[model samples]
Target: MDKFIDLHVHSTASDGTCTPAELVKLAHKTGLLAIALTDHDSVDGIEEALMAADRFQLELIPGTEFSTEYHGKEIHVVGLYIDYKNKALTDQLRQFRDFRDHRNEKMVLRLQEEGFSITYNDLLKTFPDCVLTRAHIARYLSDTKQVSSISEVFDKYIGDGCRCYVDRPKVTPMDAVSLIHQAGGTAFLAHPCLYKMNRRELTAMLDELAGAGLDGIEAVYSCNQGSDEKDFKALAEHYHMIISGGSDFHGTNKPYIKLGTGKGNLKIPYRILENIKTYHQKEK
Candidate 1:
């Protein structure tokens, strides 16, 4: 009877299909002791999630997943135990949302050029309040039968290097770590293995990020293989960084990943959250 937690998750506040309240209910039903609503580039859902947490009698951690770039590659930094009301954090994320709106317009235009007959207005009508993302575009394509599947939309049009792809404005990894700290949170590299870098390169990047106040690395992730876990653990130990993990669940948006358990075999012990809290206390 070990308590489990999901440190990374998204709701309709971002690209995820679940609303904050629904996500909280699902976490309780799934028997997770706690869950962090780390929506991409936004904390808009945190307040709603917090209310749901109280109603459901579950622990909720206020967090965000900040998008960043390093050497032109997209990197994600997870900010745990953040002050969601922090003005600096909100302002910065608002700037990013503005950039995202502009980028979405460009993407829609690119798709229209390809004779897709879709418009940004159409996406707005479908997802009125949710943040627009490539996933939304993919969903639009899939729903209209323009693509056979969501994966096809990515593979054929909107994925990185695809014809309709457009890069959003992002901060440097150092700046991202700094922003997390500014919001009174610890920054952890999200899913390092997903970067697909060689061991040496990855080590160097982690070393640099550690120097920039990166507090942890996601050593136990839903998609991680046994070898990946071992490697990430070693890296965390070597860098004297805290270890973290999560399911990265997105509900129906990513149907394969589950809430606390990922792929039906993943189990993240509660000790990880305890360790993170311990580190936060020590930092204070």
Candidate 2:
């Protein structure tokens, strides 16, 4: 495999199996040049990742993956090269965590009422330090014979319109992009193809996001097919946006996905790192 950097990864601070420091070590062993611990909606892992980066002499980019809403569908925006210590970002994450806790409680109740009999306690035990997500619940169900696998759990129980599916409050896409920019970060759409939008719809969304101050898009993703990658690359160029890529690593929750890299199906341009270096050089 060609040497590369992974821009999207997670740690136990959110939903990944590895800790932040462990993730950095894994990146080093895997021969990655640089990596970003873009945990979901939190920067708690950044400090630890930073420590590991220093020890291993690896370049670490502080980042986060935020969840937002657009047209009633979930939109994930990735903020790279961020100031993890920014107070406003931390405060907003606090609010998001609070909401997530409540949402998890509701989901547990719904699952119990639907004859699953799984308690919130069981989920918490499985994810003591990490945020409780539907993914965690799915894992629990799969482990206990309630479901065959994580994907099956989502498909039959907790997925959209499934027995335990519930809507939670989400930040608006515009607001999310603005927050990242305000924190001195570049905001990009993560896995735009996963939204399953058609060409016209994708174009419309890209336009709207550009207007909202989005700076880039994930042109290379782990699960993106060859045609999808081409389309996203073209889209990024058409919008004059930065092209980024990542494996969307989640440790055990997604054992198939690895740390600090995507699957063998991507070609992340090295220019993305050069662009970021240039931007920071100019700022300095």
Candidate 3:
């Protein structure tokens, strides 16, 4: 049997629908040899996932998906095999996390100003202990019948400079690379094609990130359109960087993506992780 793994995944510690233990249980059930819990802006789910993976004897990489800025767009950087317990890692993460809390608060106020019946208190009441990313806000709006759908909420209101959107303080890609490396982990740009960059623009960004000790590229993804995977793989080779892949599963929040086999055609071979381990060893 060929072993497969998901390098990117999410749980309720961020915006995902499933809890940490549930993600591990689901990954084990789906026959995945490993899965990295790269929850957005949070590593809170990793502990429970680690315990669950231990029960199943599966490998769960403690990882995080941090949002960084480039020019004006939001860029996500994924850190894999991180020492999640490292004080330097946790402290910096916590410091930046307060920005998210403030952003959410301001967004709710902006939405209310636009005559939407939302508030920070109501948001917390509905989703206690959940990181209130834009996804959660969109869901709250849709569930309250304020928006026809989650997509509608973004289209009309809070989709990055829409009427109610709020930007966090800038954390550049270089900053992200430094943080991940400080935590003794490998950093990869997640879903590069989705950044809406032309080849020239994308390559330029990759060059900039590479200089900051970026270790790899997420060359395979569930949502990759034609030739995207091939092009990304070529870039990784051209840059002498490692390659990684994942489904970017969010459970019901992103119901179309499946673990291990994403969108019915995605399969990440275990050799990718083997290569990552080899590179990580050499670098250390």
Give the whole-model CA lDDT for all candidates, comma-separated: 0.91, 0.84, 0.90
- Superior candidate under TM-score, 2 versus 3: 3
Residue 114, candidate 2: C-alpha displacement in angstroms: 2.4
After the best TM-score superposition of candidate 3, give how far the Cα of residue 25 lies from its true spot, in angstroms. Answer: 0.6
lDDT per residue for candidate 2 within 194-253, as digits (tens), equals 898889988888888989878888888898876887888789889988778889998888
lDDT of candidate 2?
Answer: 0.84
Q: Write the per-residue lDDT of candidate 1 for residues 1-284, one digit (tens) a residue.
A: 88999999999999999999999999999999999899999999999999999999999999999889998789999999999999999999999999999999999999999989799899999988898889899999889998789999789888999998998879988898998899999899999878889888898888789889899998889888769998889888988999988999998889999999878887888999999999998886
Model 1 alpha-carbon drift over 4 Å, by segment: none
> Which candidate number has the best lDDT?
1
* Model 3 lowest lDDT segment of ten: 88-97
Please report the TM-score between candidate 1 and the true structure. Answer: 0.98
Clashes of each: 0, 1, 0
Model 1, residue 83: C-alpha shift (Å): 0.6
Q: Cα deviation in Å at residue 251, candidate 1?
A: 0.9
Please say which candidate is ahead in TM-score: 1 or 3.
1
* Rank ordering of all candidates by lDDT, starting from the highest: 1, 3, 2
